[model samples]
Target: MHGPEPGPGEGMGRAVLRGGSVLAAGTLVERLARFARNVVLARIIAPDQFGLMAIVLAAIALFEALTEVGVSQAVIQNRRGHTPEFLNVAWWINVVRGVAIFAIAAPLSPLIADFYGEPALGPVLAVAFSTMVFTGLMSPKVYALQRQFRFGASVAITQGSGLLGTALTLVLGVLWQNVWALVLGTVFEAFVRFVLSFLLCPIRPTFRIDRESWRDLFAFTKGMFGLAFMTFVVAQADVFVLGRLVSAETLGLYAMAVTLAMFPLTLFSKVVQPLVVPILAAFQDTPDALRATYLRLERLIWLFGLPMAATMAVAAAPLLTLVYGPPYAAAAAPFAVIGVYTVVYMASMVSFSVYLAMARPELQRSFTLLRALLLVVSIYPLSLTYGPVGASSAMLGALVLAMVLQVANLRRIIGLRARAYLGTLGGGLVAAALVGALTAALGLLNLPVLTLAGLSVVPLLAVWGLLLFRERHEVRALRRRGGGAAASDR
Candidate 1:
């Protein structure tokens, strides 16, 4: 079953590097396609179209939060995760939750539309939310692929769906020039992923709901649902509060600001996170190895994320002007503020992944609940006073608050000292600060806008590159440790 004993040149290090590379390349292509679609659609459609779609998406998020059973996560965490009976029951539960969410959301669509006072959204929400049905039916066996380190095929299938959805959305946006473009794109994304799961995944989950499966499923779901609820609150609270506080155009601008500000974080979660969870799970029995892996990934994530966040913050005004044009200029301030939030959010997220890897979802629930509570208290007044800027500031506050809690938990759960996290993250902080300071200093001089931007970005990227090169040995050591453990484990 296993390949020949890895030679000196090959081991866990090579395995991880190869898998990580596959994930990175696939994620990059997927993100580029999606980003290009967003850019073109932003240019084609009015800002208000994004605003209306935001409302629909928020409603869908609410239903998902309420119904999340942690089925996918259960599969990832449970020992018998790959068994046919286990997978089949989880698949059925997922399908049921999807149907239940649609059933609950359908009648409430009118209420949500009325809440936003956008009558046109009622029909669109109903139609768009039906995609969850397809999503619910997606094969649970996909998690097994990641678990087995067959990521190349997994990435291909997943990214293929993303590419298809992006192209479909682009076509609709260019032709229809309406909100339906986003609606169609999202629905297509769900549909395509569902179809691909069946084609690509090795296992086929037939209809079943055994008692053993339910027990395993509920054991994970209980805490997961709480985390999902709090996550929904934390994620959507801004839009919910802003929808009431500001005009649709203003809300659209704020949404775009948050999107661009958190671009790197979003991508990390999409690409890098899938790798971290399964890899860390392999090190669950070895404390030193787990910690080493955690620290390495935390640094690796920030190595890339911090500078990107800083660049977004520094070039906010110009980037907005250049990318989405002049109409979005007001978003520049909020973009800068939310950019700071991205740094904190990404850090806390890495720690949270540790909890998930260790099978302690309750810790994650606690962090999410704490952040949600803080956001609930602050988002209203902050949005009232500072508008998008205030909302972004409030988000940063919640991330900081939750990070402190997460650090304390990590200390207790894994016996990791606060100093270790600080030490690991220090390099990224220094590099990002250097990049930010350089960009800020350069901005003081009077020069052509494009030339100034180019001058600021070109050198700092090289600095980031050099830092990454210096860390090469550290990365190799971490991977070797992780790979050795994973190989022995197999």
Candidate 2:
């Protein structure tokens, strides 16, 4: 039921503030733990082995995307989504989707292996893909919690399970010293999430189906399924192209580089989605408020994302060498390119939550379709010629194009002011360029790895200082305009 619009004093705003902070902290912890695990594993395992694991992960992700029904989204959006009947139907759909993905993908593992020319991938894909089945059985009540904006339990469960899973990977990587360590960690993580899903959410879903609920969910999911495919292409097409055209060692290096390059974007999404998505959904009917919040978030994300993107782009080689050791140094070039791609992509993704909140999946779907088409035309030839660097460049160019289209659409639909939006983006570009130049000069000084990494933060710190100054000026303007301006800004 749509309740009365809750004000800041009524706890909704406080809940969002509190939950967003917790999710941010939790995501940071989880990412740090995973990063440490990867650093350790990279030392123990061969680049080629990591490459094989990357392919396995990509394949599993492909199947998961193919079978996505957007059940959580359906439950979150539907009127009676929290009821047992609706929850049960959604749960059952997830269960079936999971099984179907495994069934279909497992048999085709050999084909993927053959296509990639990695024989071991056949069995590896079958084993790794079983995580889908475990994930499929996760409780639908998790969505109920999300719909209610009660993120504490969800954050606790996910972060705790993620840490445990990362620990397991470290242990297994030390003992096994190969790709299976990563595979088992993936499976363990899924199983833990599946178990925690029920434990954290008290609403037990029974084995029952409701046709009406299913129809409602399907109504949302039918379009989402298509969007999922396009999303997959936008996300993993580079990996797919690189997997085919490059050596396993090269693919592995690219994977690690991309992982580091994507860290800020990943962290941004992990923190933002659980908080912002529900908030947007609640205010969807209030277009003015929604647009204001969306704009605020877009600016906030750019302010935060650009500095990190700049750091990664400029410091890719030293950062990779310092983290994963000298063996993976070749990944630096592509990593730098993809680092810029991520910030722009991150800016575009902020709008995605708005699309979902407004129930306009087709906007994002069209964006992703354009991106996928650009990739389809560009990735193969690029990968064929220039390998990972060309592939990364292509991905960057495609997103930039699609982002322009998306911005125009948002302006038409939401009265998005070009000057208002582009100001932050233009500022970000300036900050990123400054950071890049500073870090590059530092690199030329032949500093030690630890010194280089530490000194690289100097540029980022300068960016933050400038941002803080700008924020102060904005705050003063808001204060001078009186309480109503401050209220609107918030």
> What are the runs in model 1 whose C-alpha is more than 4 Å off?
1-10, 487-489
TM-score of 2: 0.92
Best by lDDT: 2
What local distance difference test score does each model get? 0.79, 0.79
TM-score for each of the candidates: 0.94, 0.92
Task: Report the CA-based lDDT of candidate 1 relative to the real structure.
Answer: 0.79
Candidate RMSDs in Å, in order, are 2.4, 3.6
For residues 1-490, write the lDDT of model 1, one tens digit per residue: 1224232324656766776788888988998887778778888888888888887788889888888867877787676777788888888888888998888888788888888888888889999889889889888888755665556766767888889988998999999988898898889988998888888775565655678977988877876766787888988888888888888888887787677777777777766677677767777777777887787777776776677778778877777766676788789988988777777777777787787777778778877888998998999999999988888788888988888888877777777888887877777778788888888887889866656756767646887789778988987787676666765445
Please give the lDDT score for candidate 2. Answer: 0.79
* Poorest 10 consecutive residues by lDDT, candidate 1: 1-10
